[model samples]
Target: MDQVQESYDEFNLNFRIEDTVIVNQTEMEGFNAFFLGNQSTCQQSVVEGVRVLSYKIPATLPLGQFLKKQLYKGEFLSILSNILNQLLYFEDRNMPIKKVLLNTKYMYIELSNLHVQLIYMPIEKEFTDCNVCEFVQNFISKIRFADMQCVNCVDQILHYLDSRLMFSLREFYTFIIELQKEDILKDDIDLGEGETTVLQQMSYNNITPYLVRSRTNALIPIEKTEFLVGKSSECDYQIPDNRKVSRKHCSFRISNGECYIRDENSTNHTYVNGKMIQPGFDVMLKNDDYIRMGDEEFKYWVR
Candidate 1:
């Protein structure tokens, strides 16, 4: 049984080692830097009186579990593109490429956005024997395509990888982009608004959106792409002296140039217009929309 403790910001995925020796903060931080996703921060703690190594997770499914659901061409490309992109990221920076966990059990994915998360141990020089070539081959062997009548970019990549002994990250990425063209852009996929509250994709890249507090008439700028709001000091927007507000209330995030809000399972909940939004879910905000966090209200402005 894998025991994970959930905090407001992130959940801790703990691994109990057989050594029984407590993992210090240094080792925990090193291990968690590889817990790739929205919440990359690391912390060390004890759970159930046992010494364990823990890492932050923002609720993603293991790649193996996620694959069990109906797989589409768009989703298939998204998953592969993300993994290849991660390899590219590591390669371009000249970072150690072995830190990327190649196995499906270690890899995670956010189904909503089709974003991939990889779990690796940065501290270990020899974490596993898995390498880029081995992973690529395993990935190819993992799944059988539904249709083989027509060749696609995916088939092309499999053929490309098979033909070459030396794998080049940039070359692989370039080939994927060239083959798919527009399909390579994962954001273009229609995440049906009814099922998921996807934020509005910015039409006018010229205009930047902002917010105005209704009470003080203060102008608030979006400083970060993911703007966290709450009464906690850790939040980007720290609301003070508000008993109705939770420490980590909600967040406004700009994904792929579009903006949206998510209720962070706060006690009072978040309201757009008049109705309260579901916790841990997204709600798209438009220009002139009123957002209420507890009693604090702000008018979203796009101009």
Candidate 2:
């Protein structure tokens, strides 16, 4: 997605075309290259007594209307999956994404199946003025999730968008897929990939989790299910004045009496017992495990 960008052609027509000037009627025929035939994804039509051509998606509501209302987490994920898959398809075909409409109103969806359909012009110019990030920001704002996993995911996405100067759709798609997978595997953090969640509740009410600074012996209690450690002030445990530490470094996920540590792609990386842990993969912490984030060291304490 980063490799594709829209550049202006200086030699193109600058003068405006008059209303009476002959224009290709096929230009008004929506996506697919065929006439106003109802098919998968998008439908095209013209209302009786109306001169203007139209893109009509039958049996679906505009995403703006479908959204801006209460939606389940599953519905949200389905919509995103459909849209991103289409964008990826467009990218593969070398189609001009700028011609693809990103607005919620232009995108259609069916609530029951959470189907998404986007309008794309085949013309030799960009149709919509908005970018993908702007559309996503607005789209995300309207979504309300009932779970902490989703809430945390939304916060992380917003933070990522704000911190970065340039946004890539492909990168965003990967991050979103990770977020979705993480959400799906939240209950089964101990399980391997493709494993099912057992959904048994573990009683850890008597026990608590905490961390200790190895050098200073400062005790910091693990208060949240998802705890953050980084150089940024926003983190729960901020390691100050560390150039090697990323703004949002490692994360601690306390689940079912076990503490899972994740390396958040930090520069110097995160370690467990002197071994470098893979970034983005969660490693369960044991009693008195030696954990290192950049130059700072800590000991995971659970009782």
lDDT string, candidate 1, 89-171, tens digits: 55555445665557787666666787776654434333432346457657755665655521354566676665542344566
The most accurate candidate by TM-score is 1
Stretch of 10 with least lDDT, candidate 2 = 1-10
- Give the TM-score (vs. native) of candidate 1: 0.48
Clashes of 2: 0
Can you write out model 2's per-residue Cα lDDT over 1-303, one digit (the tens) per residue? 001111221111112333343333443343554322223322222234332223435335666767766655555766776787677666666665666768775666655566676666544432433456676777888887866656766787787666543445666676667666766667448665867664332221234577899778999888777999998989999878778788999999864334688999998999999999999998867558899888788988765
| Model 2 regions more than 4 Å off | 1-30, 33-52, 125-128, 187-303
Local lDDT at 249 for model 2: 92
Local lDDT at 215 for model 2: 71
Worst 10 residues of 1 by lDDT: 198-207
Global lDDT of each model? 0.64, 0.64
The lDDT of model 2 is 0.64
How many clashing pairs per prediction, in order?
Answer: 0, 0
